[model samples]
Target: MSVRLGRIGYLNVLPIYHPLETGILPMDCEVTSGPPAELNKLMDADKLDVSSCSSVEYARHADKYYLIPDIAIGSRGPVQSVLLLSRRPVEELDGRTILVSAQTHTSAALLRVLQAKLWNIKTVFTTGSATDVLGTGERPQAILCIGDEALNLRYHPDYPHRIDLGEAWRELTGLPFIFGVWIASRESWRQNREKVEEAARLLLAGKNWGTDNIGDVCVMASEESCLNYDEMCSYFDGLVYDLGPEEQEGMRAFYKSLVETGIIDEAPELVFLP
Candidate 1:
C-alpha cells in the first residue's frame, strides 16, 4: 500500500499543509483530511500511516505511533483558536457545568488540568452541541470550543470570561501548549520506514517554507475564513509549529499535570521517529 497521510481539516494547519497543497513538496501519495478526533480514530485503528494527530490521542496510545521530529501545532500564548467561552470567570465556575465541544480531546483535557492545577477549582464538563443543550433551558457556566468555531466565538461580548487555553497554559506552566503533532504510525513504519521518512522530510520542508512566508500564507488563509488579512496574520502569529527541546519540555509538563489529575495511570514517554 502507498503511504497514507492525514491532515487536520482546519485552516490552522495551512501554515504547513498550504505548501503541500500548492505543490511545493510534491509527493505521490494519498493525503486524507479530517477533523482531529476523526484523524486520531483513524490512527488508533491503523487506518492512517501518518497524520497531524491529536496530542491527547498519542498519549492515549503511544505505542502505536512515532512523533515526527521537530514539528508541532502549538502556541506560546493566546492561541485564539482553543477557547473557554464563559458566562463567569474561570475561578468562579466552581461546581458549575461547562459545555465542551465534541471535536476535541487536547483542549478538553487542558481545561481539566487548568481547573485542577491553575484555578484551584472544580467544574463539571459535559460534551454536547451548545445549541441543543441550551435548547433544553439549561444554562452552562461556560462552553469550550476549538478550531474555527472558537475563533469565531472568541470575541462575543456576552462571553466576558473568555480565556485562551494556550495563554492560560503559559501563565500556569510558563511554556508552549502543543495542540497536535505530526506522527507516523508504528504499524506502517515497521513495514515501510523509508516511505515514512520520505513523508516526514516533505512535511518538514513544507513547514520551513510556509513559516518563512507567513504573509503569503495569511493572504491565502484569509480568503477561506471570516477573518481579514490582519486578523489571520495575528492568528498565525500566535501559533508555533516547531517541537524543539522547550516544546518537548512543555509536553512533559502537560503530561505531568495529567498524571496528577489521574487522567492516565502514568504519562507515556513521547517516542519520536528515528
Candidate 2:
C-alpha cells in the first residue's frame, strides 16, 4: 500500500504542497486534506501514515511518531494565521475570557504559555466553535483563530486589536514559533520504512520547489482563500519552511514554556527520522 499522507487544508501550507499536487514534484502516496486539529486526530487514531500535523500533537504523543527532518510550518514573525483578536489591548485583558478555536492545538498552547509567562495575565480560556459564541450573543473579550479562519478574521470589526501569536513568541523569546511539523507514524515506519522515507523526501523536495516558484503558488492559493495574490505573497514571505538549528532551538524553547505553564508534563525529545 502507498503511504497515507495528510495535508493541511490551509493556504499557509500552499507553498509546501502546491508542487506535489501539480506534478512538479512527483510523489506516490495517498493524500487527505483537513484542518490541523482533524489531521492530528487522524494521526493519533492511526488513520494516517504521515502528515504535516500540529507540533503539539507530536509533543503530546512523542512516543508515537518520528519527525521529518528540516521541514515545518512555522514563522519567525507575524504569522498572519494564528491570531488573538481582542476587544481591548492584550495587556488589558487580565481576567477576561478568551474563546479558543476548536481547530487548534499548537496555537492554543502557545496562547496559554504567553498568558502565563509573557503577558503575565490571568485569563480564562473556553474551547468551542467561534460560531457558537456568535450565535449565543456572548461577546467574548477575545477569540483565538488559527489557519485560514484567523487570516480572514484578523480584521473583524468587533475585535480591532490583533495579536499575532508568532510575533508574540518572538517578542517573548526571540525565536520562531513552530506551529506544525511533518511527522510519520512509528508503527507505519517500522513496517514501511522505505515508503516513509520516500514520503519525507518528496515533501522536502516539494517544499523547495514550492518556495522557489511561490508566484505560481500564490496564484493557485488565491483562488481558494479570501486573500488576493499580493496578500498571499506577503503571507508566504513570513512563513518558514525549514527546521534549521535556530528553528529547532525555538521549538525547544516553546516546549519548555509549555512545560512550565503545565500545558505539557515534560519537554518531549524531538526524535527526527534518520
Candidate 3:
C-alpha cells in the first residue's frame, strides 16, 4: 500500500518540506498539498497516512494519531503570518463582528483563547476569505488572517492595528507557539510501520537540510509567494522546526490555556512514535 503524505501549502512550512518537494529526500509516497484546515480534515478522516496538521488537532484527536518526533512549524515570537487585523483596538472588539480566515484552525482557536483569556473581550465571529472581507469594501471591524494572505495584508494601510498571534502568545505565556506538527493515524502506523518510519526519517532529514540551506530555500520561496527574498528570510528565520523540550512546554501551556478557557475538555497527552 502507498503511504499518503499531506503537505501544508504555505510558505511557513517551506523549511520542513523544501527537501521533500525538491527531490532531496526521495521516497515513494503520494503527496497532497492544501491549507492546514483541509489537511486537518484529511488526516482526521485517515485519508493521509502522515501529514503536518494543526498542533491543536493532535490534542483534540490524540487517540487517533501519533506525532512524528522532533518536527514542527512553530515560532518563539512574531510569526508575521498570523495576524489579527482590526479597525480599532483589541480591547474594543466586544460585541463586534470579526471575520476569520477560512485557511486556518489553530490560529482561529488561538484568537478565541486570546479573546477570552487575555483581552477579556467577546465578539461575534464569522468565516470568509480575507480578500472578500478587506478588498470588497465590506470590511469587518476585526479580521483574522493567516498564512500568505496575512502577509499580503501587511502592505494595506487600512489595517493599522495588527496583532501578531505568536507574539501575543509569547507575551501571555512566555513560551514558543507550536502551530503544526507531523501526525499519522494509529491504524496506518500499525499496518505500515516501516513506511511510516521511513517517511518520518525523510521528513526530519528534509528539515535538517532545509535549515542548513535556508538562503536557497528563501529564494525559491520568494519566487512562489508574495514575500520578497529578504522578507522570506526574515519570516523563515522566526520559525522553529525542532520539537524540543522547550517547545513541548509551550505546547503544554497552550493546551492548558485551551482547557482553562473551556475550549477543549482536557489537555491530551502528546504521544510520539518510537
Candidate 4:
C-alpha cells in the first residue's frame, strides 16, 4: 500500500519539504499539505499515514503514534516567525484579552505555559484570524501569530511589544524548543513497516538536501512569502531540524511544562521506530 504523507504548508518548514516538492527524494506516495492544526486533525482521523504534526499532538496521543526519529522543526533561539504581538507590554496585559491564531497548536500551548510559569499572568484568550485582528483596525491588546503571518507582522511598529515564543522558551528552560515532529500512526507502522521506513528515509534525505542548499531554499521561500531574501535566509538560519539528544531533552521539558500547566494530562515517553 502507498503511504499518505502530510506536509505543513508553512515557510518555516520549507527546508524540509522543498526536496520532496522538487522530486529530489523520489518517493512513491500521496502528499497532502495543510497547517499544523489541519495536519493534526488529519492524523487523528487516520487520513494520513505519516505527518509532521504539532509536537504537542504526540504528547497528547502517544498511544496512537510513534515519532519518526531524526527530523523536526525547532529552534534554539529566537524563531523569527512565532510571535506574540501586543499593543501593550507583555507584563501589562495580565488582565486583558488576547487573540490567538487558529493555525497552530504547539505555539498556543507554549503561550499558555509561558503565562503560567513565567509571566504569572491571567489573561483571556480568544481565537480568530490573525489577519483580521491585525488589519481590521480592531486589534486586541495581545495577539498570537505563527508561521508566515507572524514573520510578516513581527516587525510592524503598530505592535510595539513582540515576544518570540521560541526565544521565551529558551530563556525559561535553556533548551531548544521543538514545534513540530514527523510521526506515523502505530497501526500504519505495524501494517506497512517497510513503506513507513522508506518514507522516513526520504524525509530525512530531503531535509539533508535542503540544509545543504539553504541559499536556494531561501530564494524559493522568499519568492513565495512576503519576507525579503535576507529575512528569509535569516529566518531559516535560526530553525533547527535535527531531533538530537538535546532536542529530545527539550521536548521532554516542554511536555513536563505542559503537564504542569494542565495543558496535557501527562508527558509521554519518547518512543521511536527502529
Tell me model 2's lDDT, rounded to 2 decimals: 0.91
Candidate 4 structure quality by residue, lDDT tens digits, 1-274: 7899999988877888878877877878899999999999999999999999999989989999989989999999999789999988898988898899898999999999999888999889899888876677876788899987887788777789999999999999999999999999988998999999899988898889989999999888788788889988888889999999999999999999998989988899999976
CA RMSD (A), model 3: 1.1
What does candidate 3's lDDT look like per residue over 1-274, in tens digits?
A: 7689999998887877778776887877899999999999999888999999998899899999999999999899999999999888889889999899888889988998988888999988899998875566876787899988889896677778999999999988889999999988899999999999889898999899999999999998889788889989999999999999999999999999899888899999989986
Model 1, 1-274: lDDT tens digits are 6789998988888878877877877876688998888899999988889999888888889988899999999999999999999988788899988899888889999999999988998888888866566557766779998998888777766678889999999999899999999999898999998998999998899899889999999998888788999999999999999999999999989988898998876888989998
**Which sections of candidate 4 miss by over 4 Å?**
none
Ranking by lDDT: 2, 4, 3, 1
Off by over 4 Å in 2: 135-138
lDDT of each: 0.88, 0.91, 0.89, 0.90
Can you tell me which runs of candidate 1 are displaced by over 4 Å?
Answer: 131-139
The TM-score of candidate 1 is 0.95
Q: Write down the worst ten-residue block by lDDT for model 2.
A: 130-139
Which residue pairs come into collision in candidate 3? none
Greater lDDT among 3 and 4 belongs to 4
For candidate 2, the per-residue lDDT at 59 reads 91
Single out the weakest 10-residue window by summed lDDT for candidate 1.
Answer: 130-139
- Candidate 2 lDDT tens digits, 1-85: 9999999998888888878887878878899999899999999999999999998998999999999999999999998998999
